[model samples]
Target: MNTTSTNCYLLAIESSCDDTAAAILLNDKVLSNVVATQEIHEQYGGVVPELASRAHQQNIVPVVTAALRQANIDKNELNAIAFTSGPGLLGSLLVGTSFAKSLALGLNIPLIDVNHMQAHILAHFIDEEGYDKPTFPFLAMTISGGHTQIVRVDDYFRMSVIGETIDDAVGEAFDKSAKLLGLPYPGGPLIDQWAAKGNPKAFPFTKPRVDGLNFSFSGLKTQIMYFVQKQVQQNPDFVSQHLADVCASIQYTIVGILMDKLKKAVKQTGINQIAIGGGVSANKGIREALTQAEKNLGWKTFLPKFEYTTDNAGMIGIVGYLKYSQELKDKNNYIDTGIHAQSRLKL
Candidate 1:
């Protein structure tokens, strides 16, 4: 496994969730990234793990094929295969891990395992024009449907989690609040859209008083549910009448909670450089707040491109390329065939 050459082609697969994705990376640059989102979970109001895994089983092959075709690279040209191996649904992870293992075995290339959360942070390292990579000793906040954590990143593979959610993640809080408002599945974005037109202070919600940098959103979700129930009981048309106001207030509170913790992380670590990732990082409200922090708080914020902010193989490919490059110095960068999927992996 001598990858001393400048050109290293890697195929990355990501099925850690409902999206079945694949990407081709030439070193640190992405050639093509393909994602097939599953809409089957919409009827359930949230992701059904069984349905998600089934969809991944059906989409993985075509998704990988499409990625290769889009990259104009033959499968034989790949030097390594990488797949997300943990911190996701067991069934979904197995689909990707099995495929990546078989592909690497057949092609006789290196098989690399990527931690999903680590990929979210390292996505910043992708060689994208106009985007500056964060230097070492930066704070990374990963907010997603299943996770919420603030990490201390010292190097490419050196990371430590400083704080995390004790209960529901911030994304869950957003989606669950949207559900209470009678919004459709995957409703976080819709709330953001409506919040823009309404007054964020129209209906104020109290931010949870959690200690330290750790977060707790389950209480906030409960508060929203109770408020919605009481309002609807008094007036059946309350939600319809105050939809925008409710959305604005909710978004404002959630953003406040995130910013508060980030401020604490910075003060505790004395690091002004901040980076955010995961699906929720794409929220307009969060992005706006981070941008404002740049001007108001004098904090250096790093945001990934909209496409890389979500669950995609482009991020996974970047991690793969990074790990492959590290293999030259560390012989333990590759995974054995006995490697299995992990549903809960920490950074």
Candidate 2:
């Protein structure tokens, strides 16, 4: 992991979930990010762990090959292989971890074990700088399918989760609400689309009352469920005709809860630098709310581009590249069986 003599080219693998993504990031700038999504799990209405593992088995090799091909990089030239190590489905993480280790061994290169959640936060550093970089002592809010947290990012490799949800994540809330509205799998995006057209105040939902900067979405999700259930029962055409209003109302409620906690984090931490990432960062309502908050509060804000907003290997590569540059190697990267997946990891 002594990187003074190391090259910057990295081959990253991300199979923390249903997406088997591979990419060649050159000096932290993505050359090709090839994500092989699992289409078979759509019928399950969400990610089916077993089906995801099967799809990863079918996609890893081809996806990695395509990434290298697209990046125009020879296997021998890759400086290292970075793979997601935890905070994801065990079966899926194992698929990417095993493949990356083998490829690293075959190429006689080193393996960089990446924390999936940390990668999501580090994603804000890709292909952009200046005010775009969230400065040290900054507050990082990561919202994803399974996790939501406010972190103190002192540096690229040094981060600490300061506040997090006791129950559901923002993305999970969106997906659950989408299910009740008859949306397809990964319905978060569909809800965002619907939210764009409706009035946010159309329906009133109570915000969570966590004591500190931490967040809790379980109650809000349950409220949405009951509200939708009753509304749909009262009028069968509720979702069909009033989809926009329903989506807007739900989106407003969630975004409100998220930003409320974020503002409180800013007040307590006294950090003006704020950055938002993860799959939920792609949300329109959240983006607008954060932008308006910046305007009202005079706090600086940073948002990753849409492409880097989701789970991807490119994010891992950039994070690995940062750690590699400062010789910040993992202390425990040598164990063979230690390459297994973890459902949670502290940054």
lDDT of each: 0.93, 0.85
lDDT of 1 by residue, 1-347 (tens): 33467688899999998999999999999999899999999999999999999999999999999999999989988888889999899999999999999998887788999999999999999999999899998999999999999999999999999999999998899999999999998988889989998999998888999899999999999989999999999999999999999999999999999999999999999999999999999999999999999999999999999889999999999898888887756534485898889998887
As a TM-score, model 1 comes out at 0.97
**Residue 264 CA error for candidate 1 (Å)?**
0.8
Q: Estimate each model's TM-score.
A: 0.97, 0.94
Candidate 1 least-lDDT 10 residues: 326-335
Question: Once model 1 is optimally superposed onto the true structure by TM-score, how far is the C-alpha of residue 126 displaced, in angstroms?
Answer: 0.6
lDDT (Cα, tens digit) per residue for candidate 2, span 143-249 = 99988999999877778888999988889999988998899988999999988899889899999798887788889888888988898899988889889998999
Clashing pairs in 1: none
- What value of lDDT does candidate 1 attain over all alpha carbons? 0.93
Q: List the lowest-lDDT window of 10 residues for candidate 2.
A: 328-337
